[model samples]
Target: MSNNLKKNAISLPGAIAMSIAIMAPAAGMMFVPQVVAQYAGSSVPLVYFIALIGSLFVANTIVQFAKRITHAGSFFAYNSAGLGQTMGFLSGWLLMSGYFVFYPQNILVASFFSSQIITQHLGINIHWSLFSIFFIVIIWYLSTRGISSSMKADLYFVGAEMLIILIVVFAIVLQGGADGHTFEVMTAKGSPSGWSGIFFGMIFAMMTFMGFESAATVAEETSDPKKNIPRAIWGSVVGMGLFYIIVTYSMSIGFGSQNGDEFAKSILAMDYLASTYVGDWLRIAVAIAGIVSAFAISLALNNAAVRVIYTMGREKVFPSKLGITHKKYATPVHAINAVGILTTIIALLMGFIFGPYPVGYGMLGSFGTLPILLLYVLASISLIMFIRKNHRDEFSLWSHGIAPIIGALVMLLPIYGSIFPFPSWPYNLVLTLVLVYILVGFILGLVLKRKTQNLVQDVNKIISSDGSEKL
Candidate 1:
């Protein structure tokens, strides 16, 4: 196993594109609006606003870490540097697990949209599993081609996704909304559950912005990582933050603020908005955008996930095969292939058992969100601890201390909401599954610590070394 990766393979724009593509604003708008509307009503934008601020705090913590350490492991490296080897190993496990769960979710989304678009426009009804399988192949190939290829593909997908969203937004603005533009949505007046509803909606709203920090995952591959990684992190956070706010507002007004109930009930809110504000042609375009968004996020997740596996493998925390990169491409070929195969299998099994929609919108979607949120909370806490112990002289009250604390606290609200008023069946069980996964990782970490003897020291050495050196 080797720690070497293709150096300076990603430029600043590429890094930013990877982060934004992972967020998949098109997919977020397509799926999130109706759910958010159900809870926050016309205040959907407000929920996004709160989510944006919270995500910024998380992004800030990540950027601070990025400035110091450049590694393929990203959050895993940050955790190792800030906490210890055990915690860092667990962080890698948790993140990898989250992506494993999310891969099926992405597949389901792309499949669903692809099927929907074909059935609606072409009058052809293809099963979603076919689309899922098709996308799996595409993602696998792109991810294995290396960071530069994946980032380039992401750039095109993100551009198209953004253009479609902007078109819809501008159309809504020009024509005016159902009840016209108003500030009432920003308040609790439009929500059925009032402030509680707003808080509840924020849980889902925050999920829409998940993966913006993934820019840090490519630190080893990015040019001038110390400068570009932070820019990418902030760029993705602020860029998507504004995108979510404007798009949500447009959807709110497009659906008519007074028609909150109808909007909440809409399963295809984005398509509905397109039809109402633009035309049927635009509705088809939104569906295409959904497919592109899903693909982009899948690629981004693969890129981030494989790197974590590569780092763990290099450290002998997981299988060493994952640590080895493609000699030609310098990509984590084994890890990428493993993830692609596993994801395809999971997507098929879930689709066969629960049906595509349930696997897509219900189980896989709900399962993926909590684990990632848990990672955010852990990462934020790690940032605070890392700064206090190691970088006290360089730390600021806000950037190092107060910000991460706020970020962790803000992140906790959603984790609590996901569990506590827990819904029925599968969702209530997701937390238990996540706990079991973490426990397994903990035990493995303990075993590795005993076997490796100097695991923590090795991790510290890796973090402390110059970026150009191979571990």
Candidate 2:
């Protein structure tokens, strides 16, 4: 094994695919809109639009940073360039936590939805845990096949995943929907609780866009990363942003916008819309595709998590063993296994504790979301500091200053929702657990204060001495 990841192995499309697949478009649309519908009512589309704006604010900061720093530890490196070793390590630590928790969500979701299809079509009884184990093994194997294999797998899966969902969404528009198309569904007036309710729904709406940053993690491995990584980041955010808005509006009207309560209450909104607007065959097809979408997500996230962990390993932030790559595959072998292994352990634990349907998915997904939101807040601050310190002459009042400030403030909405007027049990447990996890990292940072210079030096040497693209 060698301590190197294959450079220039990924192209622009591969990077774009990585960012989009991690969003799990099909799985996200299938699951999240209904949750948003609960408060936004028929205004689900409006809520998503607002969330898209918030995402853009964060995206701008990431894009600006990507133009200058290209490294495998995407966010970590960006933060390090601006914030120094301690804050940078903490940024990576929170992001790594988010990814580790995010991976098992796909295992649980894939098993939950696939289980429905299997029991309905084949008349076989199988526990979701069995399906969970099946998926865990498949993800581990696919990940080990190396970066090229994983990126190719996601391209096909995300394409097919987008196709089936779009067909159904467009079909609803053509049919003039269940209530003959009303503009009311797209208005703030559509919400049951007015603007406040819309704000609340924005919590889940923002969560759906969680994985858009997956592209940034592969900067070191991608060709023309300075250009490609920023483009990939914008491509995912804009592409998925529009996709989320249109599809949600279609579902709202398809369910007779006034029936938002019923829409939110459905077990699987996509399956319901498919069976109603098209046919049962379409529902079955979506179910099958949903499984593929979930797998694509699992695969994409595993690829990203490995790089983050690999970067940390190389810098001695974590065990050195995790820094090694396979000689043939040129993939971070130990990092890949660590991601898969942690996912496997969590899948069984959460599945047994909560059952893999609505409860398990909610608990895990929310747990994953809280930290990343905080990470973005910190990263936005890092952008300003990075620009002012390293590229002082180029810093702008807006781009490096005002924009990152707005981005940080925008991200605080969801972080606020996660706490104060606290979420109930389980979710409360997640909040508590995440706080303790971060606290532990903070304590570790203090303990290693003297060694921080070494940490930053190792992180810096990972990037070659070549000049960066100008801001």
Candidate 3:
């Protein structure tokens, strides 16, 4: 009946590894390669660097936020505590929506890649949607098992994924494709868009690095969050940023100066190019990496989303049943089920809504990027406010105030660009989800609040007595 709950079952290393598994999804490197190739074209690696720098500001805000609050809901709770109730609820709802999207988005990616491997390796033709459904069910089952199981799986996935990435990089080096592709491309100008292309392409580029701040949300479960969370956040940012830069640059070079068409296909489209350089084995390995990468993203998001819903339930904002933890598994079974069901429905509908292209993949990715940036934007403002009003001792001018203020402003750019009219389908899909989510969560939260308030209050009262005030 006391306020404290059991800690996150995963260790700090496992959490970091799991977090890396989440953030370093190999699919990330493949996402904007075409956009970069199309607009920035040869200069796409520069876009990666540009995006990495911008993403670093967001990562800094996340690390700072983590230093202050150790909440399972990450930026949602941070925004709520730092800003106010309404904004916090909005933030939580937005974040929850983002996390919810992660499930389908990832399943789409995994299903697609898994199908590719099956078709290529086994000569079996299966529908991607069915495979996607199968993968979702498996991911849900694994998620319901516990964070420890998920994290352990992540360690294996992460190792395999990274190996494939290294193989691709090594292939590029061994082939001696381009002497200065990575550095020289930045200086080349696009056809009509020129620098504007890179600027706009930067939006897509930044999205690839979306999961770097995931460590903050899992802080409550970490063993020594104060030290570990901060370290993990920053370490993740720099490490993952470097990884993106290397893989992106390597892939572009491996594709050769004239192979823009091949690189334009998808993030791992270069895996085909890798075959030319390193042979068929590495290409198959890369496909396996993609599947694992997608699965890892699902694992991380499921872990975070379940915790978010459980936090809401614990706070009396949702049904208390959702707050229940499985006694044997010690996992948030109900919350996991709720999140899984919601994500699966969304994924199925997305398939119908957008057809074979997997609208869920792009829509989920875009929307996920926005709420995260908004959370950072709000967090930056909150940090400034939090320092000015309460903790003058925490103020270092740059660390507590100006840096976050600037960080918030910079983070706002993509959010603005994303919602504004763009010719891109991904942008519009993101915009639709953002507006739809806010409207849906607003109405739902209001109704759920009204319905659950008395119940939660009554339950809290009864639990406080431990039989003294029997129902």
Candidate 4:
């Protein structure tokens, strides 16, 4: 087995597929709009629009590092390259921990939807664990086959789900929705608490775009890491941002913004909107799209998470056993297996422990979000210091200095919202858990520093390209 992933195995569309799939546009649209609408009132579109702009700012910071560093560790490598190897290892540890935590959210979603479809349509009350086990088996198998194969699957799954979702969105536009096409939903005035509501809702809006950076995680496998990676990152963020806004806008109008109280509570918002605006057939189509979206996201996470582990292992920052790749498939087999086992363990444990829907998904999802959100905040700071030290001559105030500072600051809004005012019960426990995890990472960093002659070298030994190409 080789330590290197299959280089140039993924093209631009394949890379873009990884980002879009993790987002699970259809599933995100079905679930997130309602969650945001609770905070935004009827101004869900406005919140998403705000999140889009914010994401772009942060995306710029990520693009800065990605253009110069291509590695499977993604956030870890970028932070290390720009901030120093210590911060880099911590970033990798935190990001991988986040990925490991978030992996089960996808499985929970897939199982929840699968169980719902089976129960509602077939009247077969099967256990949710059965569906979860089935999907994990499939997800693990696909991931071990190699990224090119998994990404091709991602491309297909993303296309199908988006098509069904877009059809309903278009229908809503053409028919002027339930209350006629209106711009109120795009205005802060429609919010329950005006700009405050809309801005707060932007926190949830940002989560829908959570995995857009997964593209960078597969940089080693992607074609033209320096050029195509930037394109894929920007393309997925902007493209998905627009996609989210349109869907939220359509749903807002379709349900009538005045009816937001009801819209904000619908678990299957897409099914209701499709049925009322289009027909029952489309409602079923949207539901199917949600299921496929869940599956696609699970696969995307499986691919991205394993690669992060594989790179860390190859770098010797983690157990080297995780770095081993299938000689024939050129895939990270051991890391793939690790993610599969962990996700199933976490999903099954949490699902049974807290009930999969409200408590399990909601609390764990929010917790999983913190580390990655912190990655963005940390990466933004790293961008400034990295460019200043590494490419002093090329650094631009707008591009490298002010932009990242703004990006890092804006990225903190969600972090603030996540804890401030203090969340209830188990959610509050996330704070303590996050602190403990970071402390553990810090202690691990100290031990590694003592063992390795040069911690930086060991932390960044894994490489893709020399990263000298002008982008």
For model 4, residues 131-219, the per-residue Cα lDDT tens digits are 99999998888777777888999899999999999988998899987789888898886787777677668667877888888999988
Question: Model 1 lDDT vs. the true structure?
Answer: 0.82
lDDT of each: 0.82, 0.84, 0.69, 0.82
116, model 1: CA deviation in Å?
2.8
In the range 129-210, model 2's lDDT, one tens digit per residue, is: 8888887787778778778778988999999989999989988999988888888888887788898778778778877798
Error of 2 at 108 (Å): 0.7
- Candidate 4 lDDT trough over 10 residues, lowest sum: 462-471
Estimate the TM-score of every prediction: 0.95, 0.96, 0.87, 0.95
Say which candidate scores most in lDDT: 2
Q: In model 1, where is the ten-residue run with the lowest total lDDT?
A: 450-459
- Candidate 1, residues 1-471, lDDT tens digits: the string is 345789989999999998888788898888877888888887888888888989999999998888877777887778876777777777887888867776678788789778977897799999899999898898888887778988999999999998998898999988888878887777778888788788778778876788888888888888888899999989999988998899988888887777788889999888888888888888878888988998898888888888888878776777788889888888888888888888888888888888777444567767677777888888998988887876678879899889998998888877777766866777667667777878998888777764333445655665556644533
Enumerate residue pairs that collide in model 4: none
Output the lDDT of residue 219, model 3: 68
lDDT of 1 at 342: 87
Clashing residue pairs in candidate 1 are: none
- In candidate 2 the C-alpha lDDT for residue 19 amounts to 90
